[model samples]
Target: MLLQLCLLYVTIWLHSVSAQSSSIAKPGCLERCGTQPVPYPFGVGPGCSMERSFEINCNTSFNPPRAFLSILGGEIMGINPTNVRVNMPNLALSTYGQGARILTVVYGLSTTRYTFSDQNWLTAIGCDDMAAVTGLANRSFSGGCVSYCQSAGDSGGVASCPNDSNGFGLGTGCCRTPIPKGTTNLFVNLTDVHRNWRNNKLFSTSYAFVGEMVTSNFSYRLNDLNNATIFLSDNWSAKNTPPVVLDWKIGQQNCDEARRNLTTYACKANSECVNFDTNIVGYLCNCSKGYQGNPYLDPGCQDSDECADNPCDPNADCTNIPGSFICKCRKSYGGDGMKGGSGCTKLPPSTIINVSIDIDYTWASGKTEISSPSDTRPFISDIV
Candidate 1:
């Protein structure tokens, strides 16, 4: 009966704690843009987000709905505090172009809190194609990859280009390179590696793009390389674009500097400031340990009731405290009360121990007096 009462109390206390937690988004603003959560400092309307750069547009005209980064116009697939997953357009080049001109695509978010995360790769898919991805940071940086087919004939090794096990474009049908850190503006250039792309009847179109490292964004079959008609249809639609991960922070200032301006600082109570790992001048906010909730909202983070999970041994007593919990062995039980530790065990209350020691010391007489060893014995009980 006592254990049941304790469990009930814990459940009630946890519910209250969770109820006191603040909203992930702003108070009056809509919490979700379609299926994607529009959490601050990213919101869908005016005065909903921290600033213009963080605004998200919920386009309801689409069949289900779509969320887009207002500044970059990139379709948002998912969002968290530190990163956003999006699908940006792909750069398609035709084989008939030859050296006439190089097709290029550019995506810029240089003034916003978002940066191209290294989790994404600049990928090119085609036969006899070369592509280069460039980012403008402290300086102009570029990386390139090429994909080629040794022979276009059906009996050739073109069928073995993409790895059979995982369908990753290794070199024959697809090639990829990592994007540099702190990339805010991206540019991709696609060109025919050889002027004889028109001669290869197997491949008519090639594509270059930057996408997150995931199977949904990159996996392709041998037929995907041969069919130029696929890229011309809905296959290259906005919804079908490759996913890209972007790192985001609250402001273009370090944690120390942002903390000094409490009125304008993004972090609320029970939260801490964290700077971006890269040289990007910005900081992010996170709930402090033992707390959970949106760090960007007021009434900020709330205590996470660890005792609600019944982490202590069944025979032990659990006490909920601010930011932590305590466990103690029940009456007549021994050992630490933690479930993972030396849990409570049955022990007799009358348990005791006797010891003997010899003392050789004198009072003020400046002489050493030997004391009986038996009197120095101490008693210890319930030592499990």
Candidate 2:
């Protein structure tokens, strides 16, 4: 009977707690842009978002509503309230530097540039190929990769170009280099395009690009040169590009800097403003650990229910508090009863043990004596 009552109480507590902290969008603003959950600080229309940069345009022309970024043009996949993600636009660039014009894929350096995620790899794919991907790096912004292989067979010179189960003449040859933090723009340039191997020289074409880890074939045989066998993941040859993962924010200043500007400061009650570690620039707002929802709305940060998962033992009581919960042991039990904590157990009763005692007698003097075999130990306070 007690267990039933406890469970009922917990259910009510969870519901009430949630009701007090429901996530709310701006007044009269659409909570959703197409099918996407338009969380606060980010909205589809004016007066809905925290700033101009946070605006998302909902295109209803498609079968389902599709959201696109006005500043960073790309189709929206989905947005997580806790951890936000956006896809940066992708473009494949391929051209040979015959004598001077060495060109390849590039991402930023425009009026509107994306912070190329550090996760994206700057890759070079070819035999006798050296590619450089320049961005923000080591006080400046520059990095790259280099690969070399024989035109046909084994001719030991530099590094060995190992092949897998994928047949010969198929140069799955690849070289990798890491993209660092604060990459505002990425420029991929194919260097050493024309190099002599033997009779089979590499005056042809090689590939270099900065993108995600997805592969496809690029048959590089432009005009009379032919002979462009390179395997690059992220499918540089396909016109339909994969989504580029990008971390976005409302402004370029850190939390303290944003707060100083009252008119522009966006985080609401119980919300926290965080600065981007990638660069000392952009910032993001989030509800505090115990809360959830749009931190830009009034009373925006809502309380989270920790008891929804039945975290406490049946012999304990669950109490929902602001930003946290408490699990208390019942009258008949002891110890913390919450999940991961020492659960409630049968209570311990009075305990006694045999021991020696030193005492002063008013009838005589003082004497040290051993306790009787059956004598119960004295109360701690009564001793001495």
Candidate 3:
């Protein structure tokens, strides 16, 4: 009865696998979203991606083409299943040495799965500029790092440092701070923050944006604004901010809860759902140990041939499984027979064969005996 039940379960599992829909973008469908290669789990146009959440817009009107996030207004630089990097809009408001102009930049986040990464730093530029960046990191957290020059001369100065030096100009003139996790929404306020530091003439020109970590050397000269490129010198433009990282996930619920529903469950066969381990939201789907490729695709993750690495000893046999591999000892060996373990060891030298004979030696009565299979053939009695 138990055996029958096991067979039924196997049949059901196989059926479930066959029923999974194929959503991964294959040939004929739109593959290149702008300059970026939209892999499975993320795609361009309809029916080409895992879902609408992963849809990307390929704007072809541009000369070289460009990919844009459907919800966010930024050029997509690269997209992986787990993380994304983009150059966000460098929305800015500068006086241009004119009247006092205040620029407020607001970035709208559509879902809970993505958040500005800690890998980015909120940076502010300009000598007499004051700026503050605030965001909703699951709460109303305000007051990020502020940037303002201590004095006009402080903004520009000659410097020299070792070529091997690796560090950022945190407090010298421009200021930088970290963005909190779970922050979906972002607002940059160039309000009264920079008012006090402004001079009567074209004194305070400021800019603020989120970008990757900043590093510099002592060769920099602060007084020469044109020479400073790391933070100052007005290098950022309205169309681009420094490279920023974005986190991504696969499912709405925890790993266990998503596993119950086969229809809407994101992970395909031979894949495992992993819950988010950080303050970032949502769960990720990954191929099992010995598999590779998009776990969200039909037929599930593809098998990775681990035996190609010659993982087993020469005397042992290695069998590649769907998501794993196995090793076994050879015919006349005894040991784990693994690649790194004690390999197939030879058997002992002694050969004391035991024999068993079964026959009707007395013409009427026949009896059976048991012994080694190799020795029984040699023990047969001759007809007397």
Candidate 4:
């Protein structure tokens, strides 16, 4: 039964691929399966998918359905639903917000992916407070922002003047510094610290997260420690992939270098073979558009047809074309293809001719274009 189900799924996927080849807006555009809109270079349809490392299984059983991006050989991160807003967990703080903390999370990349060759380091933030963040073991960087005020004033509400002066993380409320490049496995600690500030209730609210510079805004709310609402925005990029950015090249190689010896290299038919730019070792395969499967196998990328999935108006008929489908009026129909027409009506012959003749070539074209530019305009105009 499982085998049969798998076969059926493969067959359906192939048909879907073939039907959607022509109308695909972006050649390699990623699609949103459930609530999560797969970003570019990572797609849901066949052949449009990323490497196995980036495959995401979209589960459609939940209320709105959810998608899980796979990592670490199929380990699940979390589910993202379609059209639903996703809020990443925030990095929490302890030690009355004065301590620097680091989160150890894996970013999908190898060691050679950093451009500067120097790994990323920890940056600290505070007022009269200095903290250091670190990654791995030896890689590190340090800097802090200063808070200045004179004679605690009663004008700004309660007795807490220094604390109230700093706004949210917009810069004035707190300070932040940059981490070095290539750093991973982070750790944070306080250095060049002032014990008096730590003891005070105002400075006691100091907090930190991995990517963000400081936790300055509305006095590090104590409840934030229990709530996973803060998160650090880490800058990570993969090499030899879509949305090119400066980074260490992973599986890249020139065609000539790869083609000379095919034993070790694994580029398949219809796929371009390339060498790693940074390491000068290893090769990778990229299947062209309109096809997807195992690039290393005899068959490459297969087409995908979205219409089979019934992603169209229910009342319309889906006619599958090579790489796409044409939504049209069903048999014996007269109205637009969106909603089923009153099946074919026998208009008075006189009326038919009059209707045809009344439509001027230029006028008809202009009206049609103006009314339904992509032919997707909802049924609103009179067709008679």
Best by TM-score: 1
lDDT string for model 4 (1-384, tens) is 999999999999988766554222235444566556564233454555435434455667865655554332221223221111121222323344534443223332344322222212222333344444444423344443443212122124221112222221333223444444444344454433445445433333333433312223223322222233232223211110011011232234566666777774555555665553333344446655434554544444444464656644555677766545566554444444443344333334343332212222244445533332334533444343
Alpha carbon deviation, residue 119, candidate 1 (Å): 0.8
Alpha carbon RMSD to native, model 2? 8.4
Q: TM-score of the candidate numbered 4?
A: 0.38
How many clashes show up per model?
A: 0, 2, 4, 45
In terms of TM-score, how similar is model 3 to the real structure? 0.67
**RMSD, each candidate, Å?**
7.6, 8.4, 10.0, 16.9
Give one digit per residue, the lDDT tens place, for model 3 in 133-246.
Answer: 778876867665554455555535533321221223446445566676556788877643545655442233555676655354323344443322333334534223567788
Candidate 3 Cα misplacement greater than 4 A, ranges: 1-27, 61-64, 111-113, 148-169, 191-203, 214-240, 277-281, 312-317, 327-384
Which segments of model 1 are wrong by more than 4 Å? 1-20, 97-102, 153-169, 195-202, 215-227, 236-240, 345-384
Name model 2 segments beyond 4 Å from true.
1-25, 33-35, 80-92, 95-102, 109-114, 147-171, 192-206, 213-241, 349-384
For candidate 2, list the clashing residue pairs, or say none. 137-141, 214-234
What is residue 35's positional error in candidate 4, in angstroms? 4.2
Top candidate (lDDT): 1
Residues 83-131, candidate 2: write the lDDT tens digits: 3345553323233444433366667633432355554565555556667
lDDT of 1 by residue, 1-384 (tens): 999999999999988766557577787887887778788888887899899888988999986678888887878889977799987765655544343233788878787878888787777767677788888865789888777666655334343233222333465667777776678898898877666654544566677777776554334455565556566566555544567898887777898888889899988889988988646688888999878898888889888888989999999989988788899998889888999999999996695777565555444456554556665533222112
For all candidates in order, the CA lDDT equals 0.74, 0.60, 0.63, 0.39
